[model samples]
Target: MKSREWTDVGTKLFLATLDGLADAELDAPSLLPGWSRRHVVAHVHHNAEALRRLVSWAETGVENRMYANPEQRAAEIEASAVLPAATLRALVTHSADRLAADFDALPAEVWSHKVITAQGRTVLAVEIPWMRAREVAVHAVDLDAGAGFADLPNDLTAALVADAVAKQNTHGNLPGLAAWLTGRTAEAPSLGRWL
Candidate 1:
């Protein structure tokens, strides 16, 4: 699927997954090591706003960064993760809607404008949608609300696996990576959490 399609599908899937959780479940530990379901939802909300900043920079030639710093990003997530369930849901929904509109409003020519990702990779503005698509789709599963990888769109799953492979491949240990990937190794490498 195209990036736009990925974005739409991911957003719908995420929102649907969120709709399944009761208020009590909001405090449950998420699939992400240290995050609660609330943290996952809040991170998704902040991500939409961050990606929107990249879009804005592309649109106007002004530089609007995703975050001032990594520490600030963490602080924001930690702070917002404690909101009431209903309020958190509404915030995530509104941020996502706002981002989608901004994405739609960007001119075709501006899509080729360069923007630096938080990871410091410079990519075309066109890549923003795919960035968001990955976040929502992956985090939907992280919510642990009966949304599993198998439930994701096939294209996104394929892309995600490929992406994981590419990132993990940077270890420069192809044989080790292959061994772990194929389940040949008794103990998989202690690869850190990515994304």
Candidate 2:
């Protein structure tokens, strides 16, 4: 999808996901082990902001950490998780708006420019938005938020499935990411049995 399209869809998906949750629901654990719904929401919000900052920094011919480190990022999310429910929702709303505006203002030329990664890699600026979309799209389901992978446009889901398939990692888990991503199963199987 185009950058503009991705930004619009991301806004919709994230908001819909947030809207489905009750104040206490945000603390519920998700499909991703050890991550609560709030953690996932904060991760999505932080990632969108981080990616926007990366693109902006690239435009300025400078580089910075996309996140201070995984530990720091986790800390930020955990801290945010304790805010009054309204405050947390407001944070998400504000961050999403900022991300959309930042992306919408980016020039066409910058879309193709390289964004240096915090880990010493680079990806095109346009790719960053796509990554943001993927996070919102997939984790929406991971959190059991109202909108899910099935709610997303088929083209987008298909693309995400393809990406997941290409980057499949077993981690010694049953059924595995490959099977789940390829429509082989809706959820992972019990780890007691592995083929």
Q: How many residue pairs clash in each candidate?
A: 0, 0
What is candidate 2's lDDT per residue for 74-178, written digit by digit as tens?
788788877787887888788878887887787878778787665566787778777777777777777776666667777787778666644444345435655
As a whole number from 0 to 100, the lDDT of residue 148 in candidate 1 is: 85
Query: Which residue runs of candidate 1 sit more than 4 Å off their true CA positions?
Result: none
Candidate 2 Cα misplacement greater than 4 A, ranges: 1-3, 118-120, 169-195
lDDT of each: 0.89, 0.73
RMSD of 2: 4.4
| Residues 1-195 of candidate 1: C-alpha lDDT, one tens digit per residue | 288788888899899999998989999999998899999999999999999999999999898889999997899899889988889999999999999999888899999999998988899999999999999989988988888889877988999888877887786656777898799988777667756
The alpha-carbon deviation from the true structure for residue 101 of candidate 1, after best TM-score superposition, in angstroms, is: 0.9
Task: In angstroms, give how far residue 57 of model 2 lies from its true place.
Answer: 1.5
